[model samples]
Target: MTTEIATLGGGCFWCLEAVYQELQGVQQVESGYAGGHVANPSYEEVCSGGTGHAEVVRVTFDPAIVSYREILEIFFTIHDPTTLNRQGNDCGTQYRSVIFYHSPEQEETARQVIAEMANVWDAPIVTELAPLPAYYKAEDYHQNYFRQNPLQGYCAFVVAPKVAKFRKIFADKAKSA
Candidate 1:
């Protein structure tokens, strides 16, 4: 199976990281900051929105098991891409909807998915489709956060709901632990 990378910023990386980690073809999901100006910006720097980075998850997946289109399908369904730079109570540039395409094919695929979602949803799709940027890895605690802190406040309240939705919508994609 060929390997490909898909960088997506839909909201908090922890939420996205948790869901993707459970997917069948997804090998790794690293929480990081992308579409930013500064290099290697700290998590705090990104939170302040001064670095212009969005909290993104870098997903390494096997194309044979899961198509890039399917990944994008999950991405659009789990988060509201219509809102600009915001998700739920989290409002900032860091929480914006963005697709950081690693290659031209990825770029086109991302755009096509957005178009598909737009046709299905009543509201226009506002998800940003951009070229891959220098992705600065997030802080240590942010990685695999939902698994490590499942009962933690944010994980239980926010992360869990997204995970449930993903599971319900894509039960076939779930990878046995």
Candidate 2:
């Protein structure tokens, strides 16, 4: 019956945005920047690392339909948590794996998820489980990037494949949305 927001950064916002948007119980997904010191950073500023922002997706979801744990599971599966400050070809602190929790319970669940992943996976999870911060929404063009620009080069080459894989794996979750 309750709604919750989970802000995460694991890689390109386009990729994360595409994956989470199709999820069941997810009300909305906004691509943004967080865990940064600079205020109201522009996309260019964050890319330069001067803003210290990580590319993130702020997701609003119904907890009754999808638990926070399930969201975290999807997050961990969508990207490589072991690659510190990078995801695939994109390399930067801006692409770092992070979970910005709004409450103590979210923090605990994030930590537990990381721990469980570390045991099963060879590499230690480098994902940062941190307190939520002020998130600066990305530019308008960046919103719904994959859906709006499905045929665009980046969406086609970078985001679409990840999204396809996610949808294939999490088909049931998305179908119910």
Candidate 3:
């Protein structure tokens, strides 16, 4: 099966990583930093907003089962794309809503999804659609953060809600446990 990667940042990478991990077509999800100025940004540096990076997840999925547009649909549903550089109480450039498209087709698809999803929110969608400049895998501790620390405070309050929302909104697309 052919697989394509979608890199997205919608608030904390932990939230995005957790939700995407449950999607049916998804093969893997890696939490990382993207669209940043740093060569190898640490979680602390990115959190400080000096790297200009968004906490992102590089999702590997089989397009035969789930289309890229569908992935973006899940993305929009789980996070507030209308709010720039923030999701929920998390506020920082690192927490911005962004799609770092891997190709021209992916770029176009992202724009189309944003346009279609705009009507759902009172404010215009501010999700940045940009060609992926560079992606630096975050520290191993950040990967599968929710699953590894499900009872952690942030995971319980912030990440778990997003996963629940994804499961409810895209039940058909969710992976069978």
Per-model TM-score on C-alpha atoms: 0.97, 0.96, 0.98
For 121-140, candidate 2 gives per-residue lDDT tens digits of: 78888898889889899999
Clashes of each: 0, 0, 0
Please give the TM-score that candidate 3 achieves against the real structure. Answer: 0.98
The window of 10 residues in a row where model 2 has the poorest summed lDDT is 168-177
Query: Which of 1 and 2 is ahead in lDDT?
Result: 1
How well is each residue in 1-177 modelled by candidate 1, as lDDT tens digits?
689999999989998999999999898999999998998899889999999999999999999999899999999989998888899999999999999998899888887888779987778787888898788889898999999999999899999999999999999899976
RMSD of 3: 0.8
Task: Say which candidate scores most in lDDT.
Answer: 3
Per-residue lDDT value at 138 in model 1: 90
Relative to the true structure, candidate 2 reaches a TM of 0.96
Name the candidate that leads on TM-score: 3
Candidate 3 residue runs with Cα over 4 Å from true position? none
TM-score order, best first, reads: 3, 1, 2
Q: Scored by Cα lDDT, where does model 2 land? A: 0.90
